[model samples]
Structures are given as C-alpha cells and as structure tokens.
Target: MADLITAGRAMSRRHLLAVGGALPLLGACARAGLGGGFPAQTVRVSAPFAMPDIAVPDFRGARPFPITTYGASPDDQARTSAAIRMAIAAAHDAGGGMVVVPQGVWPTGPIHLASNVNLHLERGATLLFSDDPHDYLPAVQTSWEGIECFNYSPLVYAFGCDNVAITGPGALVSKLDGWKPWYARPKPHMDALIALYTMARQGVPVAERQMAVGQNNLRPHFIQFNRCTRVLVEDVTIHGSPFWTLHPLLCRDVVIRRIKVRAHGHNNDGVDPEMSQNVLIEDCEFDQGDDAISVKSGRDMDAWRLATPARNIVVRNCRILNGHQLMAVGSELSGGIENVFVDNCHFIGDGKGADGWAVPIDNLLFVKTNERRGGHVRNIHMTNVTATRLRGSVLAVETDVLYQWRTLLPTYVRRLTPIDGLHVANVRVAEAKSVCTIRGEREQPVRNVSLRNVTVEQLSGPAITTDNVEGFRRDG
Candidate 1:
C-alpha cells in the first residue's frame, strides 16, 4: 500500500519552482552533448502552458577532466573516494568540464558535484556505491520524505549548483547488498520518523534535526540535485537505488531524457521533483516497486514554512514497465502544485520478478491529501495516455490518506484542501477495476473535473464514483 503523511497543521506555500536524445539514442557509451533534443519539433510536446525548450550544453568546447588521470583506478583506489572529488575540482577550476569515468568499475562513496560539471560514464563502466551508511557521513542538507533536515547525503548530490549533469551509457549501480540486510523499515527508523514529526511541529531548526547523527538509519536518495539550475541527467542505466532513484528538489530548468531505471528496492521511486518548476522528463523507462513518477512540494510544518508550490512540469514519452502507480501527487503537497502536464505516455505493468512473481499496479493518476494538508492543487492535465492494467481505479482523488497517522495521532479539525481543475483526456485503459473515483472532503469538496474521450475497455467496477464533487463531467 502507498503511504502518505499524517496531516498536521502544515505551512502554506506561496510559490515553487527539467532531456533529450538519441542516436538509436542509447546514452550508454555516449557523452558530451547538452540542450535536450526533444523539443516541440521532435517530441511534439504540447504547448498548453508553452513548455520551454530545454537547453543542454555542448561540452565539445569544454575541458575534459578524467578521474583516471587524477589517480582513480578501476580497482580499490576507486573506493578511496578522494580521486573523483579531485576530478570535480579540476572541472570546476576549468570553469566547467566533463568529469569522465572511463571504462571500468569504480567503487566510491557519495559523489558531491559542483557547478558546470558533467559526470559522464563510459560503456562497460559501473560506478558501484558502497552499502555502508557511514560512507555518506558529515551530513549535508537533504530531505527525508519531504521534511527538511540535515541527513544522509544522496549518492550523487549537487547542492546549490548550476549547469550540472550526469550522463553516459554506463550503469550506476548501488551495492545495497549490505544495506538490504536491514529491511526497508526497522524499529529504529520508525522511532526516528516519530521524532522528526515531533520536532517539525515544535518549530525546530532544520540543522538541529540531525537525523544522521544517531541510529536514525533513514536512507538517502540515489541522486539529488537540490537548489540547482540547468540540470541534465541523460542516458544512464541506474539499477540499484538507496531510496528515491532521482530527486530534484527546489530546482529549475531541469531535463531528464533517455534514461533507464530498474530500482525495485523499497521507496525506489523513479523520479521525484519536489518544490521544483520548469522541468521536463522524456524517453525514460522505469521498472520500480513504487510510484514511477511522484511530484511533491513539502511535508507538514516544514513544507508550510517553505510555501513553494511545484509547478510547470512536463512528463512525456516515458514508459512504466511496472510500479505502484504510474503517477502520483501528494500526501506531501502541503506547499501546493499547479500546471502539471503529462502526455504521450505508456503504463505497461510487468512487475513479475526473476521467479515470475509480482505486484499489480493500482491507478494511473492518483491525487491524494489528508485532513492536515492545508495546501491547494489545481491545473492538472493528463492527455494522450495509456494504461494496460490496473487493480484499482484508473483515476482517483482522495482528501484523506492518513495511513499510519489515523491511529498514531489525533487531529483536532480537518484542514481540508481545495482541489479543482483536473482534466484528463484521450486516455485508454485496457483493464480497470474502476474507471474513476472522485473523492473529496466534506469541508472542501473537489470541483471542476473533466474526463473526456476516456475509454475503460474492461472495467469490472463502477464507471464513476464521486463524493462531494461539483461540476464533474465525463464525455465520449
């Protein structure tokens, strides 16, 4: 089951704030070109809000700083973790360059990037990360599930940088063999999470929320580009992830294209763009155990304090091989979300693993919030999409998803959120347990929902379900 936050009195958001490709277009061994190739002329991205054409830098004119030249060996030296840092410095010193990881297996700890650096992996090269949590110590600023904290650093992290990228045709594998021994959530994690919740409400400073200081054991994301600009991640095959595979937080002008992600471990969401805007994701393939794509802003009081709503995101030409949901918004959207457009996508469920066992997907589009969420969501549009199979409704909007918070804590009053202007059109679902479920809170009902040219070929349940929804319409 998908778990959302227990709504507390969260802060309200005022504002918030990126690919490519092809040569046959396998980015596996390719490197050195930037501005994504998929624009209005190529991918035929809709101009509903006039999604801007992404600019990928041309690295041909930049310097090349190969890690191997800086004493990084494919052998044990790669694990030393200092050689790659030197290379990133060399690139930054050159005013921007390609920090090349040549063909070989280079083991390392967390990779902290600088502005104008492109970490390019060559084919047959695998950048394997260690499973030890302490390797990412001396916590940098990162969020765990949405709350701001100084926690574990993401494996590939860029903080407050501009014009950074991770590109190549190689595989960036996380050796979770050590960490997986400790399952997704243990007692320590639960206790730590509860502590975070308490501290968030107490108005504790984020730096003081030192989650990485103790046995908190909160996992870090595989890739995080926080407070960045002009970010690009293309053509890499990211197989094993520590947490969310790719997360861009509080960023702008981001582009992700032609990447392949098959990280099925716990909380292995393919990509999460939180408190970000002007982003584009295209030509990517995902096989995850969680939502393929989740757009979020923030969680709880920390989020309310930020008040930066996520907006102007474009997701297209992506294929979901299997996951919990094709796309989802909130449980964490207290800061709010707007102007989202998803089109020309495919949700082909095939979660069956090596032994041929799997979990089925639930919905194509899921918008969820809880009573404690005081934010608003509007201007959501999904067009020209396809879903092969689903165990639940094709589209669902729920105002209450307290999950663990239902029994863990008590709420004084429902700070119901106002949801409106959901437009889904030209959708085809092969099998759906239910066509749609428009659930709204009694205090603030959902409004202005339009589903047109939608056909559920094999709907086993109700065609439409509504609760406190006004101006709901379905057209042929």
Candidate 2:
C-alpha cells in the first residue's frame, strides 16, 4: 500500500476497498504525500503533540485532609460546602495534599478549588451541587459562552491557580431542577448578550464588564478552570449540567482522561476547551445535549481582543453516545483554531436495549461559522473511526449558522471564517442521510477538505452536497 500511494496517485471510492480496504492506503497517503482524496495543494498533516506532558500529581507522601474532619458528616442533610472549603484550605496550607471526600452522598454548594490541591472523592461518593443560583454567589471572573463576563460561578471553579486536580470514581451531579428553567434565552439573557457584544466591540475593560451585579441571569458552567495551569481531571463521572459541563478556559497544560459525562441539558457540551492549549482528552465517554466536544476560543470582538487561539489539542479513544455533533468547531471560534487531531474514537447511540446501540448520531464532525466570526480553522485530522445508525451526514461544514444572531445583533465586522486543510480517513457508518454536506459562503469558500476510505452502508440523500468549496475530494 505504501508503494502504491506515491505522489499523485488516484484512487476511487470502490477502488479503495477493492485493494483490501483503505486504512493502509490512507495512512500511506498521509506519509508519502496527498493521494486518494486529498487536495492537490500541499497540506501539512500534524502529528500528536508531545510538549506540555501534564501528569496527575502523586499525593502518596502527602497527608490527606478529610472533609469529615472539617465538620462534614454524611448523617446530616445540610450542605457541606463550608466543610469542603475548609478542608481544601488546610490541604493548600500544608504545602500540597489531598482533600478527601469519603464515601457518602454529600449535597454541597459551589466548590472553589485552590492551587496545589487534589480534590479526590472516594468510591461511592457523590457531590450533589445545589440548584439555587445564590449558592454560587459573588460571581468570579468567568466567561459566558465565548464572551468574557462575571456571571454565576461554575459549580466547581479554579481561577488563576496552578497544579490543580479533580480525581475520583465518584459522581459530581448538578441539581438541575433550578437551572433547567434558566435554559430559555429570555429577554434578560439576550439583553446581556447585546451588552457584552457592545462592550467587547467598544473595547471595554473585562474587569468592568460585569453581569454578576445585575439581573442578566446567564447560567454558569459546571466545572471551569480559568487562567490555571497544569490541570488534570480523571476517573470522575459527571451527571446533568446547567451549561457546558467541563470547560477549561484560558488554561494551559491540561490532561483529562477516563472521565464520563452525561449532561443532556441545554448547551450541555461534555467538554468545551476554550482558549486553552496543549490539552489531551482521551478515554472519555460523552452523552451530551449539544456537541460532545466543542473547541472554542472567544467570540467576535472579544476573541479578537484576547488574541489567543485554541491549538495543539488531541482527542482520541473517546466514545460519543449522543450529541448534536460528535465533535464541532465553532460558531464561537473567532480567535481561530488549529492543529487539532481526533483519532481512534467510537460513535454509538445511547447504550440501551439489547445491543446498546439503539440511539442514532446526528452528525459525526461538524464545522460551523458565520460572517460575524472572522476566525481561521486549519489542520484538522480525524481517522480510524466506526459508527452505526447515523441519521445525518457524516461530515458537515456550514458557514452561515448565525441562529438568531443573524438579526439579533449587527455584524460588527463583515469578515468570514476561513476553513482549510481538513482531513479524515478510514471511517465507516452504517446509515446516514448523506456522506457530507458543505455550505460555505460565496465570500469565503471552504477549502482543502480531504476524505479517504469513508463509507456509509445506506445514504438517504446524495453522496455529497455543496454550495461553495474549493479543493474538496472524497475517495473510498
């Protein structure tokens, strides 16, 4: 296969399988040069990142400061927020140590983690977060959506800290009975959005762009790491979130692995890595209401002002049970995104009934942008994935998904998102509406898309649909 995939080798969809399947050919093409369905231009495919090797801290030599010792008891139904806070402080005070939550159901309020602290929950432990918004009072500096604002605090938050960790086999659940009602984009929410848009456009200082003091009523993220470094989250199961579940915003050197999240509320993405770099997400299971994993920077003028791109990220060995899209790249990617690799992942429906593949995935990979967002997305690679029961297209790239923002807010800049250098290889789906759909604006056409060895057993629509694209090829 390597010998056959020389430079300028042409292979069709059927020819790909006739030559003993396409994995070898796809891989060979990547190594030798653009072959099969790749574009004529030289596209640089990136390898997995090696720098920023973040590792979980070993607290073996350190002492464990149990929350129970800090006035927490499972026998009482009252909130254990204060006790947990005290325990975390004690652990940080003693150099670095583990703040332990013993095996029990502890209903708690917001938990603000400090630097050099490992918040570990023992087996059978459950931290049920309060629903009342007041529990997350004195809102910290957190972003809502992709715009910066001070709203309600995240359920578990770490701001301007380093070397933080959240690990356990237990569950951190959000009592969404209170936040579920806030999902509606009410007048207040839209008003806040307009205010934030105006502020970011007018170059208002982020410190003064405050929404916490008003009735703006924007929901907070579940777990957010803001401006922190060397973060790790592992082996925890999170259930039900008010907004994006695990958001590592403006952080560096992060590793999230072996975690499970099932958050089906509105905008409840499993992981939203926004404006962060050198991150790795592997062996995670996501059943989300929005995109399973949405890579974002900031939005519009806000992102332009921040001037940080989400880069050097890898997502592999993950399972996508349900979501709007398996992996989505913005409508909020105004700060640009680059060098992303998603490999060796599994996509299935909700694991229910007899075979555990009953649910259907809407789309596998979706890239969305609009005229208001002027970002550049480049060098994306995905390979070696198998899925069943795909109700929508296998791939979609749309550039006009403004939702209500098309009219709600004026386009501060008429710039369009430039998408280029995307590659996918060796993927198979049992059923899908179409192989792919590309809808690029006339002003900014999607460019340099390559697909190799992708097959759908049944397609309900045309094999490919496109409005405007350049250098798009699909082979095998």
Clashing residue pairs in candidate 2, if any? 13-476
Model 2 agreement with the true structure over 1-476: per-residue lDDT tens digits: 12212110222223234435313312221232111221111212235444344444455555799888988866653437778877877876665678898898998988888767788989999998889997776555689879886567899988776667899898999998898778887776677677767766777656556565345678899999997766789899999999999999988778888999988888889999998988889999988777889999888988988889999888889998877777888879999998888988888774352245233467788888888889899988888887876778778898888886876787758889999988888999888899889999888888999999999999898989988899999888
- For model 1, residues 1-476, the per-residue Cα lDDT tens digits are 00112211121110000012111111221233322332212223464776665555455566788887888866674433688888887776666788888887898998888777789988887898988887776666789888887677799988777678898899899999866755556666676777777677778666556676445678889999888767888899998887899999998778899999998788889999999988889999988878899999888677888989988889999998878888898878988988888889898765464467455778888999998877889888888999888888778998888876676556744566789888899999898888889889877889999999999899888899999999899999
What lDDT is reached at residue 279 by model 1? Answer: 83
lDDT, candidates in the order shown: 0.78, 0.78
State residue 58's C-alpha deviation in candidate 2, in Å.
3.8
